[model samples]
Target: MALKPLGFYQRLQQLTLPAQQAFMAALCERQLPNYALYAQTTGCGDTHALKAVLDLVWEQLSVRGASIDFARQAEKLVECEPPADDDSFGARRALDVVVSLFSLLDTLRGEAPEAVLDVSRTSRAGVRAFIELTEGEEDAQRLALLIRDHPLTDDENGFQDAVLDAVSQPLNKALLKDVRRLGKNDGVSNLGLSLE
Candidate 1:
């Protein structure tokens, strides 16, 4: 069955805090390449800042009670956001990556229990946007169904499921490493963009 955002959010709320952090971190890792590619193309954003924030997220998960300054990481992420006026499709995707990282940081700081849901929704939205842009399907209802059936959407849901399963187990260094591997999805993003 396809994963629904609301259902996914409800499940996320049931997990332990560390588990949720791991889940969000995995998703952010998968999305990071989006920003990297955008930065490579436009020279408009910093992939390093985004990578630092994600690294901090994984660290927070691996070291229980790790004192990460989430606010400071967020400041760095804000600097990496694509400009509001850069209306290119790639720019919008880069912004989604930034926003997903921010949501992950917010979740870590305990400022937004719902932030994981935002990250999930944003990832799905990025898939939908990609489908719409590439396919040029203008009908809202048709586009919604198309997105639901798209291979990229299926891959996104499958990746999330794998991460959720991995994180549901007891936390450990091995588990964290495996979760990160799952997030990497063999260095390919949900949109099928390779890190290479």
Candidate 2:
């Protein structure tokens, strides 16, 4: 049976592939290995395992009618550690944003929870970042800086470089492919995730 396209589903399908990929890639880079980084983060506000927090965010928001405010959503994203306040700020900031993201995902998943995994770019950036950070290569960071310089152009080989570089990671294959798939199918909704 064919399912009708949901409104939000239509929007998700419409996002530009490169733009979405870049955003997802950046978001993925900021993730932590676990909550352990929290206490160790000290003033960086790394309290609580990051992955755990993200998990919590997911759990809390998978309810009905939940959604995030897109305007603040991007700014509210946790990219830096929280400032000192006797309590850990980084974890708090991360958690807060996750709460919003959770709502967003929940709203999106309301119609099709299963599709979430099949089409999620949420973890894309974190996975890539984890590899780069773990590898601890100067080139990785340099490449990131270069990306900043060359925004939205696949011609510079930067986007190609990103895919090639991240290809080594297990998660990157799906993430990159999904990004490309998303771009191509912009504005079109398929009942199944299949591109064709």
Q: Give the per-residue Cα lDDT of candidate 2 at 17.
A: 39
Best-fitting candidate, measured by lDDT? 1
Worst 10 residues of 1 by lDDT: 3-12
lDDT for each residue of candidate 1 in 1-196, tens digit (9 for 90 to 100): 9966556667778888778878888888888888889999899999987888888888887886889898888888889999889999899999988988887777777768787778888888888888898889888999889888999989888888788778879999999999998887787877889768
lDDT for model 1: 0.85
Structural similarity to truth (TM-score) of each candidate: 0.91, 0.26
Clash pairs of candidate 1?
none
Q: Which candidate is the best by TM-score?
A: 1
Q: Give all candidate RMSDs, comma-separated.
A: 3.4, 14.5
Cα lDDT computed for each candidate against the true fold: 0.85, 0.36
